[model samples]
Target: MADERLIAALDFHTMEDVQKLVAELGDSVSYYKVGMELFYSVGAPVVTWLRQQGKDVFLDLKLHDIPNTAAGGICSLMRLGATMLNVHASGGYTMMKTAVDRMHAEADKMGIKCPKLIAVTVLTSINQEDWEGLGQAIQIKSAVVRYAKLAKKAGLDGVVASAQEAALIREACGDDFLIVTPGIRPAGSDTNDQSRVVTPAEALSNGASHLVVGRPIYAADNPVLAAENIIKEMENVK
Candidate 1:
């Protein structure tokens, strides 16, 4: 059951690869993430195909631009029917709020279900040094709390965080607020570029509403079995 929260990252190079991976993963995963690389390469067709399959999608574009332009992007992508989408919290309050407001207006005008709008607080790739290098005075946890608060104020549904920070976010943002965490690594897997990694169960236990896993599943010897094992692992967290 916890497997339902697992969002498979379709970071593949081609649609053929995505279809093969999806076939391998099957109904075991109901959600997928389409980031810049894949989306730019194939455009909206992958989103179209995923919608056709009745799969929920997380459009991880991390849009960051002027208020009007970002809002325009959000509205355009929501029309593609992704169930979840995001903007960069670093984009500042006006940009994030404008995206939320205008997208809501567009959705209302079209009478379509509004997609979940989340914000990326801090990428799992960076650590404290990286944060400081970005010329920020605050530490990682403090910055995440601040950004998460700002995103919420901008009317976002959730924030993209690391499982390691899920508890802090839950404490700061409350239970009703969602925290969709990436950088999930099962036991004995490579950490890749993620600096704040946690197991799926650990993420769940720490108040992550959803988990996003990519390489751990896609790069395994048997992807389908790997997904099943990850689900089993997530179930065992409690």
Candidate 2:
């Protein structure tokens, strides 16, 4: 199914809203990202509930802390059975490696599916000018490439980045390493807060293993139809 490549960004406030969307979209979208906002509000139960509903959950916590803390957090998050987990690539190789090693160890012991250990190279909302404001001389592409390498060295399965940088990441990290691209906007949709955005087709064609579409699908007038259309666009590229 086309939705296999589509991850619906469930940026809702309440679990009720999550349920409503799940019932509405049905299996057209199986992967749902429970990001920081919703995660903070609902917690691990939400991840459990999503799995109970037969959906794959991408726990987008973007954990970034000391290696020990991050590893502990990964172990806890793993118990919840998330399909994917992410940490900040900027957390350095040690932190990311710590998460990966701990996650694998815990998953093996628990005998459950080990979540894809991914890293966030850079948030899609960060643009060149915005980056410059941070007083960093590193170019956006340079930073993404650097982060991708760090993620690879850390033994991560992939990196979350903009599709605009998907090819660069793919070339650097190789084909097996996952590239889940967020900040995806269908043609003519509002850019919203994302400084870097691309259409579903463009993202898939550029080597994105999956697309995380939030506003474009969830915020649409007819969410199911919108999601279906986007999925069509995603499949046609292949």
Candidate 3:
């Protein structure tokens, strides 16, 4: 159950904040995600620090570029010792395949386990209206399915999608393909900037492999208690 319940987003602005959160969460959660903000602030040093503390890290840089460029970037990320990493699915098949293959090759060369490569299908911050305005004719659900299929064909391990799309992605890509869900808000919590949101229990019951929680835990009055509550909710669902 602990394996499925959590992937706490370390969305801090400084290394100090990250250290505080790690201390607060302790072994209650084993996985931590370092997104762009924290990564930019502390760089690869943070990944080294997290490993020293025995936590598995997910580097969420969401690399997107030409195939060669994206492959180079993923190789560098693999050297940083990421357990998982993400690329933009919209970067297209060649770019996604390049990133995955390069990372695997580099890991093999270095005698380390290859990081699980996942693609970001759609950000949780956007909605159907936003997609329509951006020239997408299909609804959000259909669009997510489209990208999930594309990612699988491109040799990606899975995708980062909102929990609302988890069931459909599983249907389209099969049960083994990973779905790392973000935009999770516990029941009755403020939605903040996230538009596609679900409770941890809903995400788990709906077939999410991981729940990426940020504000609800980081901004809570008592963060440790907040994390424990989320773990409890996930246990109930399991």
Candidate 4:
């Protein structure tokens, strides 16, 4: 189902909030992104709990560190059985490559399937102005594409980018490479803190393999309907 492509983000601070949202959303959403806030708040059991519920988890820790440390962290998280894991693309090729290699080795050792490894190209919260303010010479889109290229070279399965840059990433990395786009606001939903937001249909049409939606789904009065509507929008594009 196209609904599987929609990843509901568990952005809550506690397990009670997470459980409530997940129960409310129910079968409309099969994939979930457990980002740092919820992850740090609840820890590894959250991933295990989501797994127990038969939902896929995208562990969005955005690991960024020295090659050995990053690799070690990924290897540790591997035991949690997350469906996907990501590192910062800015961590450099060696770091990304080392994480990928070690992740595979660990999976083989444990006789479990290795999670898809992706790199975070850029956070959707940063706009062109914010990027320039950080003294970045390259334009935001260009930098994102450059990072996507580097991520692919590092043997990553994909890069987390905005849908605005998804087509470019798809073109540069090819159709098979994953382009998981966050900052997805369905139609007229508030943009919230994210700077580069797109509607669910626009994101899928723009070549995003998956959409991570948080506020729009979790905050809606009827979360199940909200998620179903977004999934409908996603399917209609095909």
* C-alpha RMSD values across all candidates: 1.2, 0.9, 1.2, 0.9
Tens digits of per-residue lDDT for model 3, 33-104? 999999998899999999899889989999999999999999998888878999999999899988888888
lDDT tens digits, residue span 1-238, model 1? 3266899999986999989988778888999999988999999999999999888899999998999999999999999999999999999999999999999999999999999999999999999898889898978988888889999888999999988889989988888898999999998889989999998889999999999999998898998888899899878775
**Per-model TM values vs. the true structure:** 0.97, 0.98, 0.97, 0.98
Model 3 worst lDDT window (10 residues): 1-10
- Residues 33-92, model 4: lDDT tens digits: 999999999999999999999999999999999999999999999899999999999999
The parts of candidate 2 lying over 4 Å away from their true place are none
What is the Cα-based TM-score of model 4?
Answer: 0.98
Query: Which 10 consecutive residues of model 4 have the lowest summed lDDT?
Result: 1-10
- Residues 17-133 of candidate 2 have per-residue lDDT tens digits of 999998999978899999998999988889999999999989999999999999999899889988999999988999999999989998899888898999999899999999999
Question: Model 3: residues >4 Å from true position, as ranges?
Answer: 1-4
Each candidate: what lDDT?
0.91, 0.91, 0.90, 0.93
Q: Say what the RMSD of model 4 is.
A: 0.9
